[model samples]
Target: MEVAGPSFLLLILLLLAPLSVHSTPPPYLSPAIFAADYDDMLESFRIFVYGARRTFKFKSEAESLFLASLLGSPFVTENPSEAHLFFVPFDGDLSERSVARVVRDIRADLPYWNRTLGADHFYASCDGIGFGSDRNLLELKKNSVQLSCFPGSGGRFVPHKDVALLPAGVAPAGEGEPRGLSSNETIEHLAYARLGAIKDPGLVHRLGGDPGLLIESEPSDRETFERRLAMSEFCLFDYGGDVSWIGDAMRFGCVPVVITDRPIQDLPLIDVLRWQEMAVFVGSGGGAEGVKRALRGMARERVERMRGSCVAASRHFAWNRPPQPLDAFHMVVYQLWLRRHTIRYARRDWS
Candidate 1:
């Protein structure tokens, strides 16, 4: 599972569109795995979720089903997997050591009737389960898994290219927390500044323009942002000499002008967004100048169409089916559930 996440024009130079670069991946598709779609044998076991009082950050899908059953829940499209017990976040309604009891019973293999009664297991959450995650789990996860599919209406929360499909939770800023980089004071703002915006002549000589413009009233407002972005009739996403701010432009609805020298695999959402069709990604580094010219010469409708496609690209990632693999909370549930299976059936004793 993967997920990935922009830009300005100083015009005139826009007439020359920046050079093209490496290629990108295909469009995003939906996830195929689900409990409902599981085989009959795997759907028999009941799960007990211990997310009572919303005390824990993560819980299992099985538990959700169990709690719903306890409430005498009516049919959801009927014949949906009646996978016994499922727990949901109780929000102070259910309390005590209910979770401890469940973990104990599961570890004891209490539900496995001669190894035929225990149900096949599955767990989902933003968090990781340590049970089966023994091998890869040990590998340090250097990067955080960002669930960009659900932006939840946070102000200044620049959305990724595939956020359009998820239900937009209207929780206002600071009301609820999202798994994102914390901002103690300074914003770790990412930018795609062109050489034309710099101060020193040497900088302009080294990077893209006039040094004076960098000194003169810098363009930092929304208007300037939009203008620079709209400069070239067609944009080139110069992922540049580094990780380009392609995600930022998409947040603003500008078709990312991706020009990369490296494989687009380095970026997630590469599979879902159809980066090539929507972006002017240059495959050959030397051909960049030519591609920029072609981009600058492109018709207005083509550019706008690409912009629309960028937004359309967003429709792929939904809540359950996020743009990336998993969220922090879900990861936790998976880890715990695997632990249950291991201790109960696999006879693996982990401290």
Candidate 2:
């Protein structure tokens, strides 16, 4: 009458696995609720992220990890039948089991998915992570990724492994921008500055050509982008959402002047750079125009050094060096092709 059996345990594991899988999406990604074509593919990607996260109300740490994972996911899916370039988010309650299961699903799907999506179509933007100075990534022999995005991150905390250094002469040998000015350059009509609010209008009035060229009226534009990189020896980006723009300046080779009020006391990614070594910083108490005067007053050699440092600084961090927008698309699309053409064609696993 005493019984010993493994079948029941196996049944339970099988049932639980699929149920957990079923719990993850539609609601999490909420694609059905997506309202617009989002103008561009990038916009579509953003809207998808926005709408999906909107459904959750969680603590900041959860939000950060979620974002990192979301960006890190290797399974790239765009609706196959429609021209839709975005996929719905994985809708699920944020339990440990749920998260773990989803990660499993992604790992399983990626290689097969790549085979399905045309090799040229898209690729996962998932860059593997690594430790501070460890070759953890290299040990795995993961492919090297290109840092294709913007300001190139003006912040100081990027990890050492992530930084890419420019050789000498391409960037000056030290602590500010290099020695000579590109005399052929002319400060143009759009030359301008960016900051949250300018307490002192002195530099703003001086370098900022028209009263109309206000941060509020125009916000930051391509013109502001051109101006900051072109006219000044360097640029300063701090405060909310400055990460994106700071990245842009780095991509353009302009030195970044940075200071932050945010209590990001632990972002090792921003800590790798020597802040005062190449770029300038106005403490949190210092406002916009004041920071501007600091940049404007620096000597040409200092600017060149700063520029070199900016380039040197850019070598680190996934954010400072974003992959090309096209690369993600290529990853996603290629996976889809391989899945359709090879795996499904042979494995007959799923239609």
Candidate 3:
């Protein structure tokens, strides 16, 4: 099952064509194909976690927790030889030098690292990988799959080769349950910010004065934030190239109103879900007036339908104790599954 050398390079080049810089709108592979092979993923997929169990749980180390989860899961194999994918549990917060050292250690200790030149290996991170040393690990960057919180048209993220790690927690620690608003109680729109300034300077000033929206720089508490999210017909998500908050909007049953100039794939689960059903897109260049026009222009009935779909899509973002079916954990696993199956190549280059 291991493909190497020139054959592996050819397969990667061919498969990555659609994900190249100049690709069209519907760029990802059909989710239906993944759905059909879901059972095969559960039945045959094997992963080798390359380290000891992590005892310390840092909030930022999602990769650590993911490795722990897989260690206890059915997909993990005791033998590395049978593993379809190898997971290098590199902490996202590691210094560039630290990252390079870890990669060097893996290369020194493991025969598998050189077999396909890390083609079937993967690492997960809550923050996007942003270090030059990390990026300079040519084999890792070129061949390995990255499971990251941010997936955009950037050097760090390669579509089809990386999976978006949905940031968990519907509300912050000690927050109230995610409750839906009654049809009559919903606000026209809601926008909240716990941290970081709005990427667009004029956006907050333009939207802050509007009585139809529950817009605030920061909510008083988690209750207030969750309440506003629940009570909104639509939640504005001004993409700053970070996707940490969008899941909360969906979790509370408010359709997301994403303002991004980039492709839809910039958001999580773009490969699997039909985003138009649950989210509204406004061009970032359109400014606040454009967002207002788009939201106010939608039919009331269509808004309700999208809200319902948004709630359904939120379940995929949930990460359970042991990991559940179709939750964030399984979704990540399925992405790795896709990589495992798709890279298989058998033809000889006779020419």
- Using lDDT as the measure, the top candidate is 3
Give a tens-digit lDDT track for model 3, residues 210-301: 77766666777877777777777777766663456667777776777778787656467766777877788889777878888888899977
Better candidate by lDDT, 1 or 2 = 2
lDDT of 2: 0.34
> Model 1, clash count?
46
Write one digit per residue (lDDT tens) for candidate 1, span 286-338.
45344445555667656555645543333222122221222222222222232
Better of 1 and 3 by lDDT: 3
Rank by lDDT, highest first.
3, 2, 1
Q: Quote the positional error of residue 215 for candidate 2 in Å.
A: 4.7
Error of 3 at 30 (Å): 7.2
Q: All candidates' TM-scores?
A: 0.35, 0.35, 0.77
Q: Evaluate residue 46 in candidate 3 and report its C-alpha lDDT on the 0 to 100 scale.
A: 85
Rate residue 192 of model 3 by lDDT: 42
How many Å off is the CA of 53 in candidate 3?
Answer: 3.5
For candidate 3, give the lDDT: 0.64
Model 1 accuracy (lDDT, Cα): 0.31
